[model samples]
Target chain A: MSMVGGRRSLVIPGEIIVEGNFRAGLNTYLENGKIYSTVMGLAEIRGRVVSVIPIKSYYIPKVGDIVIGIVTDNSPTYWQVDINSPYMAILQVSDALPRPIDPAKENIRKYFDVGDVLLAEIALFDKLRSPLLKANGRGQGKLKGGILVEVSPAKVPRLIGKRGSMINMLKKELGCQIIVGQNGRVWINSVNEKLIDLAVKAVKIVDEEAQTRGLTERVKKFILKGKEKIDLESA
Target chain B: MDEEIKLIDENGLRVDGRRFDELRPVRIEVGVLKNADGSALIVQGRTKILAAVYGPREIHPKHLSKPDRAVLRCRYHMAPFSVEDRKSPAPSRRETELSKVIREALEPAILLEKFPRTCIDVFVEVLEADGGTRCAGVTAASVALADAGIPMKDLVVGCAAGKVDGVVVVDLCDIEDKYGEVDVPVAYMPNKGLISLLQMDGILTMEEFEKALNLAIDGCKKIYEVQKAALKRKYDFTEKLKREADKSEE
Candidate 1:
């Protein structure tokens, strides 16, 4: 009848987190009225709900989630993209661009050659089949002329911040176009290289300090102070 | 014609100065490899093993893909200089069989049904060996799997109990294992109280076998504590880092 852990408490696999009246969430499971943690994570308790947030893990692709991938292999019709997950996602030629192309006349490589970066969304996931990605959406295609900064997929939510507050702050203050992938890929495009670097630093700070309290303020100050220093030095 | 080998001395202490019911010092470190999804290094006494877990992802060789569950593949390898005699780089017959057994030992603890048609690969390398390589490897692989954030019912812990001379020791070192009358290695899930891997070599009476099994299980419980402690240490360190970040923000 008593909870075994408090907010921000760390727990390990098989560790009992609650004895009763709690629903397990995320990295936890319930058995015989007892909630148990299933990973090495920090415990979060919200009212009667308990969840464990994993500190380190691979990004598991989910349908409708946006992802950034590196094209690694190609077949006649599809491109194998590495999304920083255990599974390789396939982007079919039909989904690579907005319009269809003649298979016989047009080469698939020209559409999405190997080593290209893609900002795409998971279209369908039939278990046992390679994940199918749709890259035809607006702003979804081969990404170029920007820096790619990688963070932990689990911390991607923090990079986006509450209702996009943190990212919006970064964009409004720094004038950068930012795209965050659920697969832990962040693409930052800005006219100035200094602004892009500042954005990257902000993302890294979020990734490292996501579980900490007051992360938004820390990232904001870090980015703002960094930009001021850069401008001061330039002047 | 032969000199007597004393695995246990007159004071009832092991050659390494441990009691019969005592285990060797075990040190576990998680997240050692950057490229691996999950990785851990375990050093037990003089035995050192590195384990890395990759995937619950796509299965290679398309034919091997299981429609109903994920395939768990474990590779157990000993380095050329792991033992006194330089081992061959090739997988020996013993290594092949140990790999199979080790895989079976860890398979039951994972929730394979959740990741259908994928493959979870566990690679364990013996960097140094004195004794109980299989048990040490299993211990390291379990932590690596957990570190990789693979959901499971529980983490599997392993320990070896052997009858040295006439004493049933909790954990056996090289000298004791060589001269031991019987060696029983066990991998157990403490939460479920299940034995996943149990192997015995040499002779034992019914009573001795039961006692050895109990001892191995008890030893596995001790190992389970260390495993949980190591994981807690990692998470606690992360928590400390978060606290520092929060304080710096204020």
Candidate 2:
């Protein structure tokens, strides 16, 4: 009996394979073994087909990513942050350059306390697992003036949704500045305390309704309805 | 400690305008993950917890055996950015302790003897840390397990009550947690009506603690309803699919 012996023989989730040399039926003969092709498409198994699907995109730090991290001490060069997974992310001083600086400043804490929250991004994560981050970008910096909500780090993607539709909707509806730490902490800031509550409510709505189709519309309706009630009561 | 900072005024109103013993809004969803055996995301007040339960399957590493009861491993981790201050990358000592507490809390609720020698790993990731995370973890994990179809004595609902200033408050928020004098987190199996995990931090007068504990239990009962609703919603889809299959066969 011939057996398929390549990584391509296995199936990986969240991947699509196009243009194959195999036959065009629902089942394909690969390396002389019959393999089932999903009605959706075919995809190569880039990694071991683990239970958890691998994140396809380069890890971009969104407003909320619950990432576990460690402080690797600070330096004039950069403050190294070990965002627990293979990559080590860096919070560079240059990103915080525009802020006021003391010429004699030695420690970066004036900008970011050594162990303070480094809400950052994966600016560059190479094959070597070295990740450089830039907090200088909009909506990236020390999480302040808001409440933090923590959920399962793994669920961050579901909360974010395809193309940031989920979080953006929450932000727009609640009128809150939501910073999602890749480490899974979501910082919601708003002068209106009720807005903070609304942001939290919207997040929960998104989390619960992630799998549901047309989630954005549903969440928007929920928020708008809730807001209408709040507005009516105030009026 | 700022003595003047009041959680509740003499008018019987709270900082958030909630009456005593009222929980913040709660929402729950089950089977949220496509890969895990079962998964749930729960939001209680502002705190959100996502839990994934994998198996009563084979044990990894080929060792660590009990020969009878299934080995239950629980890991409770906070996202590095789950707090106002970005948290450290490593699972801190506190998270480890919380993980153990959650594991112990869930142990009794799961029917371990049924899976004999297999292992069930419960992974809880706290994307945000408001307060009552351990309790949230327990609650989320129980729902995830049930979603995964693991047999259990009952669903566990984790809840917390605390003495803020001098009065008891159910489901304390972050500010209440920072200013509050005492916090009591409790995990209870709503179906079986038993407390499985209990932990307290900060100082509470015995009467205050008792009041908080009772309030926490009550909160657990309330949350249990949400858990049941979420589970029902999760399985209802599958039931529909099964019915469709039966209809097609007929």
Candidate 3:
């Protein structure tokens, strides 16, 4: 068999990518011993697996994924969080606080009110109900004094790069705490306003040019170039 | 007095100067709206349509949510000034019927079972109407659905053919449709080789109906090429990057 991966082609939904038996991977469907793409993306036929990396898609929460969410509405039982996904997230009071609060006696709104942002992990998502979140874990709770930048969820893997190389580089260069959410939300915490602004710009650039190769290098140059300008003006 | 008007000129060309079995100029723009999860704008001759998709998300009214599969909701609306006359902005009977028709037409191609209990909303707004707005709307909404990154078996396309002046023509404009003997609009999935939507307006002989249906499917096959190009064109940067890679090799 020829190496089909050498000639990567962009395909729309229902376009056949392979003509023989192969395990259908992400964004692909298996029918009649053939593999077809189910979304608009670049097709990759590697060995026994054929997959397509979608260029743009909405967030779908999965178990153990770190996500940034805003508190939309809350009740005594749980707080309704919009994690940029179709299903609303439920942050149970027990999972959110060190000790469970009495719903009837204590005012739950004071704990996590509407419009507050938090970084949490998906404790459970069974595809039958909304995702249940746990925020009481270490380094997981209310996020304060940070800017949230949102991008397409499909670009999240690119923003992170292979084995977190791109994210580690950003953190080292900017000297800031950057949390890359699986739901396409990025949180940047820094004391310097210029550094925060640069991080936001860098995240947007990654989201825009994610389809092309060598994106991490281009982003590095942009940040380095922007950092120099900021230092010069401030000095 | 109205009978004196000729939709087909003496040179055997349509009012829009198209020959029989010829389609209107089709232009599609993907990801046109920034806010919509996925959006596309389709232009087929004088007809202009904007389609936006918002889900695979939560379905409203807890009772409406299905456990086994997602619900495909469609809204086909026309702007007040889309037609020559100022049409009512409210959903008319025809618009309501067309919405269901378009929804059923697109439902077969989508794999709704993957996202159970969610709602995939396809909104098609007719900004300008010529004649084949329903067919144009179906094609636009299909692109928008794919643009949303929803899994589907195939992309659905729509086209219409009708008998006018004892001749069958593809993609009839308003003037031809109004004076034509019969109109047949068809929604087809080329990859699956299936017809999802078929509607007829007026009477036709058995032979003419078969010929018109085949011609409309042929028109759909042609439009499918344009739809695929529009989806791929959304990533022009990818093409440029490939070009640069080839240059480095030389």
Candidate 4:
């Protein structure tokens, strides 16, 4: 059975086929091997069937997404980064850009020590299942001037919200650059340290209240009140 | 040993402002995993442990035979970055001993006779390790097993009491543990009022040991309450869902 306006179940992992006499609506796959109606809005896929999920807002890193990364390590270039996956990913220098040696002045650990969390993309997979990552993207570099908060990897989706709504709220309210590392590490940066602190607190609050409904409105109100309080105090 | 001390003071108030014999904040969430038969994540102070119960499945490797009782396999693993110093990926000897202790601790309470010829693997992963990791593992594992719906005689609560500079302190934090002379970790089934596991390190007089043991038992009793509440919360959630489904059907 096909759905109409409200929602439809995703039946298969392929493109959404809307043929003659077949109605189009928001389709989703059911576990019991049946396609059914959904209560969500309609989603349209391009030319081919929209088999895979959409990637408009917050980029949820898939198994293999070639993105830019930072050199979190030096000697061996052993880097830890987020590819939006569950695992705490690693990027080795051997696998990264292969240009060599200056022992006197250059220290690998200095390049990426304990606190120097970097940005890298997953490269190759080994038998032992370590993510061989690389840093070759445009916007990838050492995270600067941001407060990092570690959270449960499972909560990443909730923090990102349905369609980047939560993150957008923080961006608008705090006016800071917030980058969520898929490995449960969140980096928040702003010119005003207080705004950065507020953003971090807001993210944490959202994380704590992830299971609760209507969190968006609640958070929005919280940010507005916080902003007003700041304004009043400054005035 | 001589690092400027914080968290514990001359007045004996903990950083979080708990008096001596007080435990750090504990939050237990059970049945948190979709895949594991039973799972629990326990956070005591800053330390966090995720315990997953998988099995009563067929024993692997074939040769190690237990004709009567099911073999219990327990693995205690701390994430590489669980502590302040990044630990190596390999399981250290200390971790191995702790794993054995934990396995033995749970054995008596598990009713292994019921699942003879099978094996149960209890995996405890320390996402963050402060102090009292072994005790945390036991507590978390018991809750996870219960969350998995595994029948147990009673839940086990684990706690550590240590003597610092000759003063008996219950629930030693990281620094107290590092410099303190004595540490006695005990796991007990509060419902049965039986000790499942007991271990001590460093030097303690007989009287001191006994006092520490008693304090550990007290600490366990406190933790047991948390374990029960977590289990009840999870059960109530699932029960509520089932009742709603039943109502819909009706």
Candidate 5:
């Protein structure tokens, strides 16, 4: 199969991405063995599969993916969570708490009220029903305190990087606790105020320059510069 | 009829100094509206239109939601000041008809099956309407849909061909359309080789109709290139910003 664009080259919808035998991946469709781009963004050809990473898009929920969501409304059994997708996710009371409580006896809003934020995993999702969320997973629960930063859902993968190298680097260098949601919401927790501010700025930079080369190196330098200022202030 | 004034001169040039088969200058800008999910502004000759696309989100009122595919909603509105006499701000009978036709023209290009139980709304506001507003609206709305990152099989483009003074021409101005023998506006998907919208406003001979259709499709093909360029222009800026930062660091 011959690819029309080079690796990581931008492509627009209806543009021919590849010809001959190739698997049509996300943001692409197969027509008579030729793969055509369905979105305007960078085309990624990995082995036999070709997908285009869209430049700007809404988050589509996938089962088992961790996401940060805000509580929009609450019912007796489930609390509606806005995961930045077109579909609203439902977080059941049974999945949120360690023990079950009677719906009529206890107030569900006290546990997860409107405007509250939580980190949860998509337990189930399909076209038939709204996405179901379970917050009982590791590091998944109601979020409070430090900083909250949001980037494009498309850039979430870039911020985390390959094998968590970029995020791991930030954790080690800045000593800040970070949780990245597949839905483009990020929670940054640090005792130092400067570090939290720096982390927020760092994440924003990553969002803007997600498609760039040498991004990890640039972010490392930025954190170092920020750390120096914090140390000087303390001294 | 005001037959005394000539739309086409004896030199074979039209009122705008364009040849009979020539198209009007076209320009398109993508992502013009920030609040809307996706937006675009298109200018074809003296016509100026702004289109916006929102959702693929949950359908309101609940019952309107489609089980198998997303419902496509479209609105085509002309501003009160768009015409010389100041058209009504309310939706006229003509506006309602244009909205439905434009929606049908664009619906084929969208891949609605991917987003079930949702609705995608497209609004095309004719900021300045010279003529052929419906066709131009279709062209601009497709760009807005792409900007919103809605997956589609292909991009949609629209253009018009009309006959003035018994001569066929591609892309008609307001004066030509008003006085022309026939006006044909066509919405086309170039890659798919499909005609989504074809409407004739006046009487035409079989021979004249065939010529007008071919000319309109040709016009659509040329405008399709402009649409693709407008979409790329947004992303190219992001790439350029990254490259400049890398250069400064070195």
Candidate 6:
């Protein structure tokens, strides 16, 4: 059955959401004037565009996206980084450094020690090749002294919000510096222990209610209440 | 077995009291396993199969990695205690052949080229087997793959039909499969109206064969409905929880 003009309708794999004159969006496919869901998700219709937001999925690497990765293995010229994706990515010394370094003179592992977390950009991505990482950009490179919180990759967009408004709110209200990676890793750095806990809870809420309408307002209320509770405890 | 024991009665109901066009009761549950990327359990009559999907991850034995498309691997295994008589734990030749066909049946529906140099593994374990385990396995694996959020053109549903007591039946149970004239199993993509798997054993007249094929396709369409419902049930629960969370903010 066609589900055109339906708002927030539940869809499963192989169910047709629209027939003809509509474009398929994320987690959907088009065939013979029909848009079919490729995953179990909530279908949304806006104008002539139809899309399904999958309830669960893993991160897929894309070029120019910033991701938090942990170094898994290191070579003389490159290191294998785990971005929590199905494929392991390679971070080359050339892309990570401003200038090429001689492997004979310097050890690559020294630059990115095994198990070290770092923020990097996907410099090159091909389906057949492991994603290549570059960490030379501003606010990139090694992450230091912060707890890493993992959320769903699909919710990352919501966590960042429109033009980074949600993230800015958290940073301003909580007095913390937060970096969200497209790969679903969030690094929270702050001096106040209670504030860090509150930030974590707020991010969790955003991830949980990412699909809900008016979520930005709800999350703002949730974080404010959490902050109030922390202040009351301190007093 | 008594030779006089009729497989079909004068009223045309089979041994299980189902009409020739009626199918055995089937139930599907998705996301049954916590660890697998995708999992589903399908109970079709007396047969039960659990299928799990993993990866689109890096391929082991690097030489097996395909540059243009992801490799598809399937393992169809029957547990030792699943049957009346205990079977061997080792993969049998029958299982190896069924695994290959199951892979071929599902490969076309998946968007493998989108993720190359990786492998998508589907493991189908027959927890119970009365008959038509291969067909049930294919159906369950397809659901598991979709549950894993692997992009696919359509869901593949499988069903079996056979001649029992000189009549074509929609789905053949264990007894009918053993004494039936012919058993034909088909894996079909309902939306695309394409057949991915077709296998027949025994004999049938051309007219009977055509009739059996039509019956199995009809059965597959019914099965397609069940698969969609199972997935919808899962996501509906998720939506409900999200709404509850939103309401709590008031």
Q: On residues A34-87, what C-alpha lDDT tens digit does candidate 6 reach at each position?
A: 888877777898788888887667788999999999999998999999998878
Residue pairs that clash (backbone atoms under 3 angstroms), model 1: none
| Cα lDDT of model 2 by residue, B160-197, tens digit | 88887678888888888888788888998764568998
| Candidate 3, true inter-chain contacts retained | 0.78
**Candidates' TM-scores?**
0.93, 0.50, 0.95, 0.49, 0.94, 0.90
Give, for candidate 3 chain B, the lowest lDDT window spanning 10 residues: B235-244
Clashing residue pairs in candidate 3 are none
Candidate 4 TM-score, true structure as reference: 0.49
By the TM-score metric, which is better: model 4 or model 6? 6
Docking class of 4: incorrect
Fnat for model 1 comes to 0.70
lDDT tens digits, residue span B48-102, model 4: 9999988665567755637666688999999998998899979999889889999
CAPRI grade of model 1: medium
DockQ list for all candidates: 0.62, 0.01, 0.68, 0.01, 0.69, 0.60
True contacts kept of each: 0.70, 0.00, 0.78, 0.00, 0.65, 0.65
Could you give me the TM-score of model 1 versus the true structure? 0.93
Winner on lDDT (4 vs 5): 5
lDDT of 4 by residue, A33-91 (tens): 32221111123434323222211112224445443333333444466654433223576
Model 5 chain A scores worst on lDDT over the 10 consecutive residues at A1-10
What TM-score would you give candidate 6 relative to the actual structure?
0.90
> lDDT by residue for model 2 over A62-165, one digit each (tens)?
33343434456677657777553323467677755566454465666566655566566566643333456667656466665677676544457777878987
Give one digit per residue, the lDDT tens place, for model 3 in A1-235.
3447555678899998888768999988888888888988878878788888887787878899999999999987899999998789999999999997789999889888999999999999988888999999889989998899999898998889899989988998889999988999999999999999999999998887787778889899999999999999999
Instruction: Give model 1's DockQ, 2 decimals.
Output: 0.62
Tell me how far the alpha carbon of residue A43 in candidate 2 is from the true structure, in angstroms, after superposition: 40
lDDT of all predictions: 0.87, 0.68, 0.90, 0.67, 0.90, 0.88
Write the number of the candidate with greater lDDT, choosing between 1 and 5: 5
Most accurate candidate by TM-score? 3
**Can you tell me the DockQ of model 6?**
0.60
